[model samples]
Target chain A: MSSPKAKVLLVGMGGVGSVAAYSLEYGGKAEVTAVLRSDYQTLIDDGFEFESVDHGKVNCFRPTNITKSVEEAMEKYGPFDYAIFSLKNIPDISPIEPLIAKCYTPEVGILLLQNGIGIEKPIFKLFPEAYVMSGVTMVSSTLYGRKVVHVATEHVRVGAYDNGKIPYEKQVAKCKKFIEIYSTDKNDIIYDENVNFSRWRKLVYNACVNSSAALTDCDIGRLEVFGAMDPIVRPAMREILAIAKSDGVDLPEDVIEFMIRSDDGEWYPPSMLVDMRKGNYCEYQVILGNALDIAKENGVPAPVLSCMYHLLHVVQMKTQEKKGKFVLPEVRPLPADNFQIKYLN
Target chain B: MSSPKAKVLLVGMGGVGSVAAYSLEYGGKAEVTAVLRSDYQTLIDDGFEFESVDHGKVNCFRPTNITKSVEEAMEKYGPFDYAIFSLKNIPDISPIEPLIAKCYTPEVGILLLQNGIGIEKPIFKLFPEAYVMSGVTMVSSTLYGRKVVHVATEHVRVGAYDNGKIPYEKQVAKCKKFIEIYSTDKNDIIYDENVNFSRWRKLVYNACVNSSAALTDCDIGRLEVFGAMDPIVRPAMREILAIAKSDGVDLPEDVIEFMIRSDDGEWYPPSMLVDMRKGNYCEYQVILGNALDIAKENGVPAPVLSCMYHLLHVVQMKTQEKKGKFVLPEVRPLPADNFQIKYLN
Candidate 1:
């Protein structure tokens, strides 16, 4: 007898989350429910729109199940088999905890579909008894307003979160089941045993492209202009590779080469650049800053990574300043310490 | 014959150029001529205005000599004793060559009151027989419209272009003479024998504060927040120190320490940030890129400096794109070689 169909609740419907939802529903495999915080009304009222090369057009995609918050999702769908998180990791923000809390169940497995290093740590720490799987998606997507998403390419790698207490068989079983339900003609989901390796690999591309694109305001193609790949891109990747090696995560030998050559002249702006253009806070903290922290802990001198992290922070702060959230400190005059007023007053 | 008072022609009447002109005129020394490129008409018609803490407000005080271009200035003033260049260093622009070409004379010395390394090379190369000197100023000033410059604090270090062929006596003589005429109560000019040392010293501040301010769009005070000093600023400085050491130029050990601690909560925006805000190209090439090149040539690892240089390049490319001069390469489609020759025939 076949096992029951997996029930999935996806959070944060930016680009990746929405793509996952559409792929699952289009494939007609899983009972996919999505929790959208910001544009719940828009999706409910207008439905989700997706323009895909693989699957012609999806207009007003009212998902099988959708709600505003995780609490609402839990109320409507009961307990989910897997809770997939695809939210951005903005620094100084704490919305993730409540979402995880509302979705917690002893049997429900967790899957983190976010971009960053060691994102699963907090989740694993919070739910030590829970089965937590980690994922890295190499899906090129763009969001137009509240409902529209343009999926350029889609591929996903899933594995167990590193340093978790879960056994390998359980982790692989969960990942394999999720992939079986998640894969569509448009999206390819892989069950990888080495989740840490996958995270580190995706990180190389993220650290180099996302920060450079946002900073340069150039897409992948324009970034390679005037031999930037030779001087700036490769050197930065080399530095990140060293940091990754120091952390005992040996990525492929030609990872940097693969990352650079994989551009294929596509002028797709990375998500961070899109965030920067829209004056929104980017996911730099998790993407680059977290890796920088690890490098520091490992005593690896990752100067280029450190520079990229801070430069991205500068871009983030500039956006924050524009939003009126970051105000410059006021200048004050010094005191007249040695002045005598006498009778002149 | 007391060397017939130095006839000086100042180029690029931005803040620095205007400040030098005012200080010279206020000191009642030299026949100070200025080349006002953008605001020649306004300066000639309404005269120069200065609002200064050191030299109180001076309204509509016309100079003895002012012209639109180097040709006009040379035509009006006949081969001045010194041609002071207080212009910015923008890559892929050629304003300097024309200025030098029009104002060429053997007797006249060249005082490059500009920030950046190896800037004196082209000038020295052009006029092999001319006496060339380099000057780095610590003058706090800003330009208001076409005429006014508010001089806040002023100190100048004048030295010979280190790698030039001019004799030491000649270099010192020119610097001393220029300082004698250029000093006001608002400005102090000093003659330093080691110009390379001074350049490297000033570079510490430039590579750190200037690049940070421009990249983050934050003034000095705000940059200190969020521990940027520990992560970004100091690491960049350390890389620059390595570059400087490879070039055999020993900057003071306390230069970085001195620079960071000296920012006593003043919200001063560096020049590069001002230019960046105005959508103008900055001096990253001379300030950071040149150092990176030197580091590469010397085989000294300067990852932080390299990242800073490229990130600054990205910002510059954004500005260029805004100016309508930079268009991204078009995305080409794949070949249609396998199509049928006859369609519906």
Candidate 2:
């Protein structure tokens, strides 16, 4: 079924990355060079263990090459057809340009299977001529160290990201080529004509559920049990809709009901909450920050979205403080001895 | 200073309660019957130790009498001229009616030196004919167990709480009588003709700074350090102002700037934040919940305030869960073994 093996480098091989590498490689469509920053050596020794409903229990599914850095991946597997990013989108900690520039080639296109709106803009600004493919995934995969548990249903919406300068047909051709390699018979892959619409749609769920759980220190299931999803999460979803409307995307109002009901019973913690649990920085920038900037730009009165952005900013900043990346000033309690009433002018 | 000493029953001997008890008694115009709940025995053995700038260190400033329960205080010191409330206004866990009903007398006019708008309503509703006096204070006091530290400058504005049924002049006379007994030569106290004005002004600070700190798990100092005061806190203050306007009150626009500037350099954690650190339920109901209700009632779009309310609700609920009041459902990880793609209708 393969015309020729397309060489793709996947950066940040965590939950989604491992599953994607598994899906692409298992389909015999592409050979992936994985960039495992923390678990490179462990992955090289044990490889990825998958317990999937689709592929069944598979042991030690190794990539074509496992490199610890993007530069390392490029040196070994240079001039690749494409490089996919399944990493977190935290621009304050790590920017996208320097990393993407190392993997850049005129012929090679870029694929981002990351979350959040306006993520493509940075890369698009960096490499104006480079074809960028965006992927919106609904895959339930968890990579706990070297082991992956793919919990059944997987569907992805892939589309070409418009830079406005590039021809539409040329962009579609490159995007289609990515789908060809990434898609499996079992995978429900849809080619989205308008990727931004799909992104804003995904945000309706992520912005609502993820922010509610993390900010409240409650999981999604508990949030539902507390009868808070409507009062807290629904209003946030509505704000996102208002912001998206300003972007000329009319996300169907029923999508809010659909998302809330879909997550009604499931007790799974989303990515941002898990990020906080691990003491790792959350992807608040991608999830809430970028959309909020648009809301500000278009004069959309997005109160809930703005609050999430600011609150999540502090949350991320705190994680930064924990990591020694940011130093928080000590808030001294009112000094008991210095209670002098020096009247001011 | 030859006036007969007024009899007062002070409930909830926390930070503010102890200070108010001290101020009213130290003035030599009021004799307070203090309700020391948990620390009743500790305080009985070794009475309050005060380190104050205004009054100096007044050792063993025991009230006229100290009782553990409100019922005990009622029995020990009945027919009190006034019963002052300085505890948190969390209506969810503890409502106003039951507690105040025990302390109520035909002559005992209720005085609330607590934070929040619309708090006087419940007590007024219960004791419709009972004259309710409201007090707004800018006194920074901290009581760590038996130790009381008065951190200098204290200013209070006292006024009559109108229940619509009560005549304005009758209410003012009751309010003035209470203030006359509570005020000292050292204290900066004012008689407020309109108490709601002062309450809303205080809300300008409380609603913004308090919620921002608690929800973000950050102190006010850190929020300022992160350059978040202008972006996060200011917007929330503006929202409060708009909500205030709907109540037929016009808080000056500079009040936003003034509130932000006042909290600019201070690193002290606000009450809500302190409540969170102690794992005690925050006073979010009084600070954010009631204001959010007002915002909703008037159709004022308060994104930031609403976000804080919902988020704090979750935070409080999580604490409730920690205390075994709420049972958080298990958010099970996606089961890899049984990942069936059962197509739905």
Candidate 3:
């Protein structure tokens, strides 16, 4: 009997997602459907105007199928082989359950292509019986206007989340096939056995570079110009490494050094900084706050990381307030004398 | 001779300097000659268009003398009784030695009415024989246009910077007279024995409120709205207090809490943020960097303060870059793919 054709439902066609969707379609391996909101009409009507070093220009990227909502996507093309979710991991903005419940099935494996750790936990909780996995990418992509996505890097790593019951071979097979479907001549995709470690490793970079850029209004290479590495990024990275160690993940000793040296010549405004520029809330809580909580749970002191986390939190909330989603509490201006100057007149 | 009317040459008549100049003239206790730079033409031509809560509106403040340069001030009115300096403490902008060298003498006292720590060190080094005193104020004053200074608070604390050889009573006496000369019925001026401790105490506030506002682009009261008190301000204050304690100052334990709670109602943007808005360099190094260095010197950990310090440093450098004074080091953007991602075919 011929094998059933694999069907994929991808949500959130942002910078990262658009690239992934393009890569998936380029391989001509799976029936790809995209679920997009906000830009759904534009993308559906005009398709994505894509630019990348790998692919000179993809003027139009209309997926095989597109829908605004998950319910519609499922209604039109349901019981998919894989459901891919790619959105920012910021909190208090949107709910994820309805989308997951409508698209997810016992046989449908969920793949989260997002930055940060613990993003898949709530998904796993909602659908404990469903197959769930996560992927991390080092690709630099930004969605400009509503239709164009600029891409610079094109490397991705995917692995099935530790469901405790899923065997290694079975998980590897699932992830390998997913990687094959997404990998293109222009894009390189890999399947990693140690996905948790890979996520943690990426967190080390995100927790520092993303927060620093957003907070400083600086691009990555400007960090060196400002000498932020020794005082800001490196210290935060060390704290993050310690937090990882406390989580029983022993990252390499030179990981911090490697991270710094790697960025010695490059300049990229991380997605979080891009979000800040767009007046959108950042994934500070997921990327930084989660690491801090884990550090606290493991009795590790992450003062540097904690500092950046708090600063970034303020920045994010301020951004939200600017966007009119968050309203700041107004208070009376304090009487000047109440600030307390010791008087000995 | 009525003490030769106590000739005083006040330089850099910005907000703090303007208020001090007005106070000295209002007291009718000294011959206040202001050696203004940019505002000198304005003062010499139209005089200071002043406004204050303490004194409703002093239409014009034509000091006994106003000159454009230290050389001009010294050549015009030299060997003053007190060389009062009130300038923002930013580095690489201007030099203070020439001013001190020109205006100061053996009998002249140096009273620096500024918002920072370690500002008086170089002055002391240059004029070891000059009686140097430092003062801290809770006054909120800003220079509007080129002539007007609006003041909100009017309390000033002056203490003689301990010169080691100067007796406590002698230092206090000098500071007391300086305060008396600058004190008006509209302004409350007091002499303190522990000026260094007082500077550290003020640093606690500036290092927290000023840098927080400057970095977050939020006012002091807005910190509470963003919950920056618990996470950002209080932690930084605690670290600053620790540094003070390490320096044998022993600031009050409730200082941090008091600073936070005191700001519960008010929402004034600190001067550093104001400086940022003006596209001027902030006093970050003097306010936060000195505190951090002292903490490091005393072997005390100041992670929170260090975070703010680094953030403020970047902000200050960015401000300088904005003003076209400080040029950032240029580097070529990294070739994108060099991040080294392994591919599985």
Candidate 4:
């Protein structure tokens, strides 16, 4: 019956991730499996809930299977047709492979429903024959234990990463097939001819508003209303655009205005701000580090990004220390006999 | 015989202000009168204490006079030779005149024993006939109630802000006269021929290290031992230098290194950080805002400084809100009846 409905697996289910899983199951063309590691017990006991404008108060996400880990999911339902990664693309924290290796199969289309650039390269390098696709999403939402409250619009633009191992025509065909299953009238999924264009353009928002909101306690809405948008947001967007141009991507000039004027002046607490508030590790490596590396390679100066990067790095380090994942260096012992009290002595 | 021991009145008695008062009295050239508004009762009851290496656990500074306000002090001890404005030079918080007008007679030297560039402009604008001298100090100390725990070195550089209304020779004499009264062997006070040069050089440290440590929760010791010095500190220093060069002030390169490796890896919680922690208004206006204005006027692109300035402004705004000093704007309302849910519809 329709080739077993194209079995799919989903991991890293945050607010955005949960939306993807819910949307896929709602489309009714795939059997969805979600791996709930941190909140597996809470999720199973309470189930998933969403107060979405699209789905109108969805009480639960009925994925075909739920497991603690991907290996467990693979053992229950192996060789899935598509495995979607919805986690933050921080490879240092969560490695791509070993987690998805057991469920790996040739011709399995890999979709990255996450933020940041250069996420597809790692997957393609690991699973050479698998068709790699990258998806950029803008959903104003936050995730808690087994629940998501999406406030504004949820739009996704996805495109294939051009795996030369698979023929171009075949890759395009498979991309369209995934879209058929993933898209609903509400989900509003579209195919980007050049996803890099979509990505660098998104960076205009991510690298500027997201980072500023995270660093300062100001949200996007407050920042826009207040006087910070011109000083912090616009200049940072210009820097991102410069870096993107260096990498051969020309984002529009009004992309800045488009990013700022969100639907209905909603106070969007960006994902990084939420993550920092929750003491969870943020997504700086993909969002800023990758772009900074590109800037460095091309000899473009991104002072604003560099400043935010270093500050955010310190924040991440502090977060890691709080989690007992990393230890901060000891404060060097002060010299005793040097006697620096000029007036005191 | 000693010409009535110069009557010098001091307002804004925090740790640095207290130290300046104590040193001026200790030097025995002037009878120091201190204005203590918030801590007047405590200071009068408990007096002042300094656990100093130079003075050796000094208890109670013997200023010639101490009062609750400048008017009170002027009423009791009028027509003072010098009125040192050691408070944060924040005129917005505390207006200059009326507070000092009663005590202000011609030839009363106004020494700004505070941080910032272009602080003298306002002073000259208001009181053109008075000699305006700026003193930049680096003191490791903190004030609590009426007590001060002096930790490390305290060095001050004093120079005249060239009042063309007065003869150059007369201004130089007034500067040296105040320095004589303000310096003990321990005070380590030096006179800078070009105070703007000193102010710009000092900004090389203030604009970078102090602001960064305040923005991030790191101290100078930790920032040095950690890896933030290169990313946040040096680049900001370079920009400040570039702006200074644009305005015809050339600061040396080694100032960055010298500012970081303080006496024996000592932990210096910058004043702004301490101020933020204490829920007090910070000095971004003088420290960053003024410098950024200069950068803009000179057409020098100080992206790092501008970025820090904006973020710090937001932080200052939040601080103001917490203190009930400023009211933030309300979040804009969303649309009432726009039905745009594509997938669900």
Tens-digit per-residue lDDT, B1-345, candidate 1: 455566888887777777787777778777788887778888888877778666778787656788888888898887888889888767454448678878878777788888877677777667776678888887777777854666556777888664356566776777787777887766678887777677888788888888988877777665665346777788778777778888888876788988775656467677888898888889998899888878889999876677778878877766766676645436622123321112121
Q: Give me candidate 3's TM-score against the actual structure.
A: 0.91
* lDDT by residue for model 3 (A1-345), tens: 655557999998888888888778777787788998788889867888888766778888888899988999899999798999887666545656667899877778789888777777777677765677789888777788665555566898888886666675676677788887788788878887777799999887889988888887887776756668888898889888898888878899788777766655556677777777877788888899888989889899988788888877777667766767644435544544343212222
Chain B structural similarity (TM-score) per candidate: 0.89, 0.92, 0.90, 0.90
Model 1: lDDT of residue B268: 69
Deviation of model 4 at B282, angstroms: 2.2
Question: Mind giving the per-residue lDDT tens digits that candidate 3 earns over B1-345?
Answer: 565567888887888888888888878888888887677677877887877877787787788888777788788788788888887766545657777887766778888887677777777677665688888877777787655556566888888877666575676677788877887778988887777888888887889988878877887766666778888888788888888888889899877767666555656787888877777788888888888878889899888888888977776666656666544435434535343222222
Ranking by TM-score: 3, 4, 2, 1
Candidate 1, superposed: residue stretches over 4 Å from native: A1-6, A27-29, A162-164, A184-186, A246-250, A297-299, A317-328, A332-345, B1-5, B95-98, B162-167, B239-250, B293-300, B325-328, B332-345
RMSD of each: 6.8, 6.4, 6.5, 6.4
lDDT of 1: 0.75
What DockQ do the predictions score, one after another? 0.31, 0.35, 0.41, 0.40
A271-314: candidate 4 lDDT, tens digit per residue: 78878777788888889888898999999988888888888877
Best model number under DockQ: 3
Q: In model 1, what lDDT does residue A20 have?
A: 78
Better of 2 and 4 by DockQ: 4
Q: Against the unseen true structure, what C-alpha lDDT does each candidate score?
A: 0.75, 0.82, 0.78, 0.78
Chain A only, candidate 4, TM-score: 0.90
Residue pairs with backbone atoms closer than 3 Å in model 4 (clashes): A185-B342, A185-B343, A186-B342, A186-B343, A343-B186, A344-B53, A344-B54, A345-B53, A345-B54
Order the candidate numbers by lDDT, best to worst.
Answer: 2, 4, 3, 1
Stretches of candidate 2 off by over 4 Å are A1-4, A162-167, A245-248, A296-299, A328-345, B1-5, B58-61, B163-170, B296-299, B328-345
Separate clash counts for every candidate: 0, 0, 1, 9
Off by over 4 Å in 3: A1-4, A146-153, A165-170, A329-345, B1-4, B146-153, B166-171, B326-330, B333-345
Better of 1 and 2 by DockQ: 2
Worst 10 residues of 4 chain A by lDDT: A336-345
